[model samples]
Target: MISAQSLTKRFGSLTAVDAVSFEVGTGGVLGFIGPNGAGKTTTMRMLTGFLPASGGKAVVAGHDVFDEPMQVRRKVGYLPETPPLYRELSIGDYLRFVAEIRGIAARDRARRVGEVMEQVGLSGWERRIVGSLSKGYRQRVGLAQAIMHDPPVLILDEPTSGLDPAQVAGMRDFVRELANDRTVILSTHILSEVELLCPRVVMIAGGKKVADGTLDEVRHRATGGVRYRVELKGEPPDAIAPAVGALPQVDQVKPVPRPPGDGPHDPWDQGFRVLDVRAADDPRTAIARLATEQGWTLRGMERRVPGLEEAFLAIIGAEQ
Candidate 1:
């Protein structure tokens, strides 16, 4: 439903976005993420036809963003980082204005406005002046305007910004429902939101595409290899570390230090040592067998996978 091919944007002598490319299939939700000055907003603008790309191409809902700007705009619903609002207008008036400008027929404008208002939790708030609403309410108004036209594709930039915990959850659920039939590009700094809402991620850094893949694939790429957390109680703490490291299935082992006041206090946890084990393949079976032969008590053994935050830091840190 959306495709960017070597999309580049320049401002005078500076290039804001450099040859960034990715794709989102129909009914797909793609997470677009990067740090400050990473050109995430610039890319979104080009895709939505809000800003023209200096080089390359962008297609949205089967329309070329540069050649068919009007068609792309008609099919895309964009909510920028800041909710664009006219402070002087009342909530109902502002949304009605948006509906009219979006080409909603006069006969359907009222129903469209009411449905979007309720979708964004703005029901019965038509009389409230936009200027009088809080920051969270302003965001809701922005979302309502974006969806009022019921476009086939939605490009949301920080859709959950300024929202409280409950509002954030509701926004996530709403986006998930929208993805059942429409394509979505969710751009945000919140990695946890991406994990919950996006199955695939496109990460850019320094205005360049750095990583693009499924969540698990990106995590594996960032970590280099698989790792495990093994806790065991053995005859000697010092011997256990070297013994685990000496195993053919294990490549490296590092002992993890317990926190100052967070040591295990349970009787079952006594004498258990923790170590991070990295290997090409699963080493739990080997470690468990070794513990049994050595008469050591095995507390727990589990595979450890890097979370999105960890993967983000690792990838961005290397790029720098």
Candidate 2:
């Protein structure tokens, strides 16, 4: 439903977006994430036809974004980071104005506006002035306008920004509802939101595409291999690391810092030290045998999967 092929945008000496390309299937939700100045908004504006690209092309909802801008605009519903709203207008009036501009039929506009308002939890807020609404409510109003036309694709930048936890959750559910038939590209700094809503993610840094794939795929690629966390007692914390690192199966051993009395039965409290072991193979059996021979008490030995935050950090950090 959406495609970006080497999308490039430049302003004077700086390139805001550089040869970035990705795709989102019909009825799919893709999470776009990056640190500040990573070209997320620049790329999005070009895709929405709000800004022209310096080079390359984008197709949104099957319409060539550059060649057929009008058609692309008609099929895409874009909610920018800061919503375009008229504070003086009442919520209902503002929506009706949008409907008129989007060329919705007068007869169907009322029904459409009502449905969108209810869908975004604004059923009884039609008469309230847009300026008087709280930030969260205003966000809902922005969402309402974006979907009022019932467009086939949505480009939402920070849909849950300024929203409280409850509001954020509600907005997530509403976005899911919108995605039942429409393709969605959501850009946000919130990792948990991406984890909840998007199976695939595209991460960029320094205006370049850094990673793109299913969440697990990216995680594995960034971290390189599986890791195991080991907690052992009856040994000097300082001396145990070198011993573990010498094992044939172990490729890396990173110590997990535990301050005095910090964790459950804190290692320091019971003379145990915890370290994360990344090995060439499953080293549970070898670790157990080694510990038994040394008379060290094993408190915990568990395989650990690198988390999304870890993967995101590793990729973004490396790209920079």
Candidate 3:
């Protein structure tokens, strides 16, 4: 429901966002990730028509952001890093104000406000003064205002920032529920949040698009081949390394000391033998067969995959 092509934004001599381009389909949740000063906010602002792009174009829900900014604004619900809130207003009053400004039908404004409040878990707290609420509650109030008009596209910047662990979980669940039919573009530095909430991610570094794809696809670009951790009994890790390295699929093997309290006589009689195996393909079968032939019992074997954090670090590191 959102598309951008060769979008660029410059502030004087500084380029806040380069020629970054991506698209979000209907009901798609695109996680936007980058470090501080990476221009994530600048890009979002340009997409939402809050800021003009130096070059290129963006379309929101079929409306050109620059040419038809009013229409684009009508279809998009945006919550920036700081909740644009009036501390003096009560929750109910603030949301009603937002509804009126967004041109919600006067007859349906109350119902819409109530529905969004309930959606964000702020039900029955409408009378409370927004300034008096805690950070979590205030965030819920901000979310309620954003969805008060029921826009088809929601652009949330750091939607769960500054919340306690419990609050963060609650907010994540709420955002997932919000995405049932609407398209969402959320920018966050929290990798775990992206892993739990986004189906696809668009990573940026140095104001440029660095990666865009499903989690596994991005990870594959960061790591070469598969990795495994294997533990063998009856042999020191130093002695087992060269033997395992001889297997055709095995690329490299390094021995690491076993953790405390997990030693030999713990079923597989494990001592300090731990092998870090990098292989082109699944070599567990070959390694197991080799262990069997050598009379060494296999204690533990596990595959390791590069996670989103690793993928993110790899991408940003290369850029630097």
Return the top candidate by TM-score: 2
Global lDDT of each model?
0.91, 0.88, 0.88
Pick out the ten consecutive residues of candidate 3 with the lowest summed lDDT: 263-272
Query: Model 3: runs farther than 4 Å from truth?
Result: 231-243, 246-274, 295-299
lDDT against true structure, model 1:
0.91
Ranking by TM-score: 2, 1, 3
Best candidate, lDDT: 1
Higher-lDDT candidate among 1 and 2?
1
lDDT of 2 by residue, 1-320 (tens): 99999999999999999999998899968889888778989999999999999999999988999899999999989999988899999999999999999999999999988988888889988899999989998998888888878899999998887899999999888888778888999998888898898888999888899999998888889997689999987656577778888889999888877665545756656777888899869988888888898888888999988877888899987876
Measured with C-alpha atoms, the lDDT of residue 295 in candidate 3 is 77
* Tens digit of per-residue lDDT, candidate 3, span 146-203: 7877899999999899999999999888889889989999999999999999989999
lDDT of 3: 0.88
Error of 2 at 175 (Å): 1.3
Clashing pairs in 3: 263-270, 264-269, 264-270, 265-269
RMSD of 2: 3.2
User: Can you give the lDDT of residue 30 in candidate 3?
Assistant: 90
**What TM-score fits each model?**
0.88, 0.89, 0.88
Error of 3 at 242 (Å): 5.2
